[model samples]
Target: MSAFVVAYFPHLCLAFGGLLVLCLSMARSVPAGFYPVTAGLFAALPGLWAVAGPQGGSPIACFYAGLLSVIALATIGLLARYAKRRGFAGDALYGLLLWSALGMLLLADADDWIMLAVGLELASLCLYALIAARLDDNLGTEAALKYFLPGAMALAVLLFGMALIYAASGSLEIAASLAAPGPLTAAGLALVLIGVGFKLSLAPVHLWTPDVYQGAPAPVAAFLSSGSKAAAAAALLHVCSEVSPEAKELLWPALAVAAGLTMAVGNLGAVAQGSVKRLLAYSSIAQMGYILMAAMAVNDGGGEAALFYLAAFALMDLAAFGAVGALSAEIGDRDDIAAYRGLGYVHPWRAGVLAIGLASLAGLPPTAGFVGKFLVFGAALSAGYVGLAAFGIITAVVGVFYALRLLAALYMRESLIAHPAAVYATGPAATLALGVMAAGLVGLGLFPQTLLGTIAALFGGA
Candidate 1:
């Protein structure tokens, strides 16, 4: 029992943290910052243990669990001011966030179909409620509804795929099921891919992302794009690792085509977006395309590259959306691209952080995003997916334009909002969180080996 508790302390910690935060909400004298700070501190414990503690799990699983914890911490940091200002700063919101982190941690370590389903649903169900945190807003309600219905259908499809796998393999193990090849296995894997693809916002099934993101609160959008995507991507990479050679031959081509389409659609869609959140939503989709390309190369050094990119993406995305949340007026989010005009001067620190995030997402050098892209492309080329790599490079170039467009609005354009002064001011919480993320992006870019060396060591020099 002690061994079991030690192995699973991180999971137990999160469950306890959620309840603790819920109970703390009952106190009348607790400071407004107490909840987010307390939540962040509790969330950080798992990450700290995963990073500095003994490793009993695979390096990949440890890395992902730690990554999810950091994501939770950073999100709570940014959520501090945004939550207080938006009137949603309470135990219920923090409880949902902590519980969802528990789910993401589970998904990151899952090795079977049942575990994956449970983790995915646990994470996803909380996200649906979080999106509608602003209960009074019709847009929030609609966004939650849109996400929930599609998500439900995807879960059904995924469950059916799992059922088919059980029929073929007569076991619940992911490894056994993937290694057991037949027509049923093939169809089952295909369905599973479709279901996961929808969650990751890969194209053809990614129609919900933009509207949902635009309508959701900026902090909530950050959680959805970063925490949810990271867990799903990590889970998909684990699944890819378990595939047999024959199954790979069949699955690889289909995944490659999907990557290409997702890259094309996401970059193209982002180019025309006037809403900042919508643009980031499309960019988030495109980022997944690149990550998917790396996932295909898992046998040939893709695991390390995928890990690096997911970490960098979570930082870049949370920083970007956190800045947006910081700059939002009490009335609503300053979501319009034009609403940002002259705010660079009005709020230099927040705007600068936003710029760093955008530049990194555009694959600018001296940033983690640049190294992540280079590593991803290198992994794809080395793995013999040259066409996908080349196409990813091209789509990446197109992605740059939208980032530049947003930056131009920030720095070049004149004030467009009727009262730019009415925009919310940045507090210590957002500043500290965004600053850490921005610093990490540049630090990793300049010293790519900080992460690269870790990945190499973890995989025995993969």
Candidate 2:
């Protein structure tokens, strides 16, 4: 019993915490601060497990569990501040966030296709509710409708793919599905990729991303962009790890093309966007393109690169969105780039963090984003995808233009309107979250060798 407990403690911790929050949510007079406190405690459990040395699953699982914990904690922190500012009171909102985090934890640890599907649906459903939580906004309702329709379609595709794999191999285990390959199995794998691609916002299926991000609450968008996206990428890495050589021949080419298209579309779209939230949405799509490039390499080195990049991207994205959330809370959700005119002069600190995040997203030096792109492209080059690597570099340069454009608006452009009676102010809680993420971005960029060595060792052991 102790061994079993040790093996599954991380999942159990998150699961139990989620259930506890749900129960509290049902109470007639739950404390105003109860949700954030419990959620923060839940978020700490996986880090505690990490500190004690994970005793279950592979080292990769431990890494992902730790990653999920960090992302969840960050989300909870941002959500608490957002809720406080906007009077967004609801125990159900906090409960849903915890439930979604639990689902992500489950997804990261899934060993079989069935578990993967369950986790995906669990997270997806909670997100739908969270996105549409603001009952008064028609735009939120529209975004929820757009998100749900495609999500349901993706789920159907995933289910059909799973059924096909089961029929072909008579087992739902990832290893079993990969061990035996027939035409049916190959088709199943393709369908599965399509489903995962939708979740990751890989192009051709990513139309929902910008609209949803633009309409959803800023804190929710931050969580969606960082935590949810990282969880999906982790699941993609797991699925790709089990692919047979026969399957690889079919998968790699499709992945390469998708990567190129996703990068081009995402970067070009960001350049055209006038809204900060929409711009970040497109930037996220391009970042996923780079991650997919790493996935195409299909080896342990590739997986390590993908995971490292995901961590870097998560921190950078959270920093960017946290600033957006703070600004929106103060400025009445006027997320237009024009609203930010001369912000660099007025709100220097917040603008500085936002600039750093955008610079990092552009793969500028002295930020983890640079290191992440370097590792991802290096993984591709080592795998002999020279043309694909070149394409990625070109798209990355395109990404730079838009990022700098945003910075230019922050510093160069003059404000067209007068300041409101209340000056723009970021709360201490939100500021702390932004600072932590920025510090992480710089720290990871400056001293990545230790983390890289650890990732290498973990992969080697597995």
Candidate 3:
């Protein structure tokens, strides 16, 4: 019970913090930016503290709390510019974001059927409200509707699966249920996988990715990409790992198919996109394909590989999003690739940071992306999944072309259009983030032995 409370305190703190902020916001007309900013920071602190606590070193159950802490901080940090520029001034909005973050934390740690459902719903409801927070705009409302409808259906599917698992095992606990999942439990697990698959944007169930990513604000998209998706993947990995070894055979094929198809579809779809936002949308889907492959690599050191890649993936993504935030602010929210033409010449610092980020995403040398992919590829080789591993490497090579294309545009001949003198200030926070991410990427790439050693110690054989 103490362990449970210790593990669960972050969620409780978030709930309390959100409610307090809500009450305070309603009491008076605070400064336009005060509510959300304060709430966001306050909300993040609990999770940070929790993750850094003594018990965060759990082995097999994974770093459920700590991973979430990194995610919370990253998401909040990525949204700094977006929140600042948009003037998300309400207490409600901040409270919602905080609450949602807590919910994500809970979802990652869910070990019981009821807890999973509750946590997921908590996060989903907050997101629905957050999406619709764009006051006086029907478009935001429409996006929220699109998000909610499918989200609700997904939730229903998840709940039904949970119920079926419970019925088969006569236990709500994940460990007990996994001891022997009969046909009913297997079916239920499949349904739950579908539900989580939706959250992570795994096809053929990922129809909502483009709409949600495209329609949502930049920060929201970042949050969805990092926090929400990370939590869902964490939960899925936990559940699948806990299930019977025999059941894993049943699961891997589905995940493998989903991974391969999503990678091909996402990358191919991204090829023609002019909007950076849309391009990133497809990029995220492709990234998820890699993540899914790592997940499916359970027997073949998949778990360790997945964990390694997730850390690297989070860093690269946040860096990328940070660049986009700065770039968007520089050009009045112009997300078109055309606006990025010759960006290297005009905004050298931003372009450099973005280049580093793209390089990592492309899995090029001397970046965290390379190390992460190497770990996964090594795992695949060790597992003897030669074909799957080859496919991943090939796709990674293809990704290099698109990533280089961005760099080419940035550095190619300067655009004739007058460059804006006042580039969005890559203010202190952005600079700090970019620097930290850049150093980490380079450090990990060059001296991967240290990172790999840590990963092996933490996850046992990476």
Candidate 4:
């Protein structure tokens, strides 16, 4: 019982924290500001700390739990920052975000098929509600519908896969079942891959990502990209690694093709978008391609590379969207690249933050994004996927072009648009968040060995 409690502390915190927030909301005295979010944040800390602490000696430090901690913190930061200006469903958002994070943490550490299935449903259902919460936006409603329906179908496929696996192996524990053998088991694993492809936004099945991200709130879109996707990737990596390799020979090639297609489609789709948020939505798909490439390299230092990239990716992506979210409040929240025309003069600091984010996203030097790319590409090359590595490099270069468009728009001139005296009440918190991300990006890039060494050690145990 103690072992389970320690392992699942984060989920417990989220559950209790969410209930408290919901009660406060219903009482109609939940404060008109960021207090409820602050309370939630405070409540969730023990769980986050417990998970982050090197106490368990479990070797595998629950990737889903750690990722959820990161996401929960990021969401807390975003909610607190946004709560002051727009009082739109802040309490509900906070509670649901925690609930969703709980689901993610559960999904991440799931060692069995049933646990994974339940976790996936919990996270997906929360997201469906969140996507539909933007009452005034038809786009939000439509996106929720589009995402929800397909998501349901994907869940069914995943459940079916689980059933097949159980029938073949007579067990749901992934590690144990992987040790068992049969052709039916192989087919079961293949079906699982198909389901993962849908959630991970791999090609053909990724048709939902762009529309959903474009339609959702900027912060929500960022969560989907950074938090939700990272959790899914982590789970997928575990599944791939623990499962039998007989299917890997066939699976790897298909994933590689999907990675290439995802990058090509994501980048190409972004090139024509007028909206910054929409462009980012497409860019996200492309970036997922890069991450997927690393995932495919799992047998050869790929997991470490993937984890490293996930951390770097989350920091930079969140920073980008944070800047967008902050500015959106001022400029009609449209986040069109053109809307940012000459923003540098009006909000120099925010523009600088945005620039750092974009440069990092472009995989430019001195940013952690570059080091992340190098690690992934190196892993791919080591695995003899040289062509895929080359494609990643090419697409990364192409990404720079789109990222620079923002800088160009900013540097041109100051528009007549009035700079709203923004009340980022937790100015220090916001600044600290950006600084942490920026510093991590540069720090990891410069001294890549330190992080790699740590990750390598973890990989040994994983």
| TM-scores, one per candidate | 0.96, 0.96, 0.90, 0.92
Better of 3 and 4 by TM-score: 4
Clashing pairs in 2: none
Rate residue 338 of model 4 by lDDT.
Answer: 76
lDDT for predicted candidate 2 compared with the true structure: 0.84
Model 2 scores worst on lDDT over the 10 consecutive residues at 418-427
In model 1, where is the ten-residue run with the lowest total lDDT? 416-425
lDDT of 4 by residue, 389-424 (tens): 999888888888888887888778556566555534
Model 1 agreement with the true structure over 1-462: per-residue lDDT tens digits:
887777777888888998888888888788766777778887987887677643566666668768878789888877777767778776678878998888888887788999999989999998998898888879999999999999999999999988998899998889888889888888888889889899899989999999999989888899999999999998899889888888888888999999999989999999999999999999999999999999999988898899999999999999888888877762256678888877787778888888989988889888899999999999999999998999999999999999899899889988865654545666776778889989999999899898888777776884
Model 3, TM vs. native: 0.90
Worst 10 residues of 4 by lDDT: 54-63
Model 2 per-residue lDDT tens digits across residues 1-462: 898888778777887887888888878787878888897898788877865665866565677778777777877777786766666666678778877877876676778998888888888889988888788878888888899999999989988998999999999998888778788898998899899899999999999999999988887888888877888888888888888889888767988899999999999999999999999999999999999889887574688789889899889888898888777755567989988888777777778888989989999999999999999999999999999999999999999999999999889999776645336456565677788888888998999886777676666633
Query: Whose lDDT is greatest here?
Result: 1
Candidate 1 residue 126 Cα shift, in angstroms, is 1.0
Show pairs that collide, candidate 4.
368-441
Instruction: After the best TM-score superposition of candidate 4, give how far the Cα of residue 84 lies from its true spot, in angstroms.
Output: 4.4
Alpha carbon lDDT at 367, candidate 1: 89
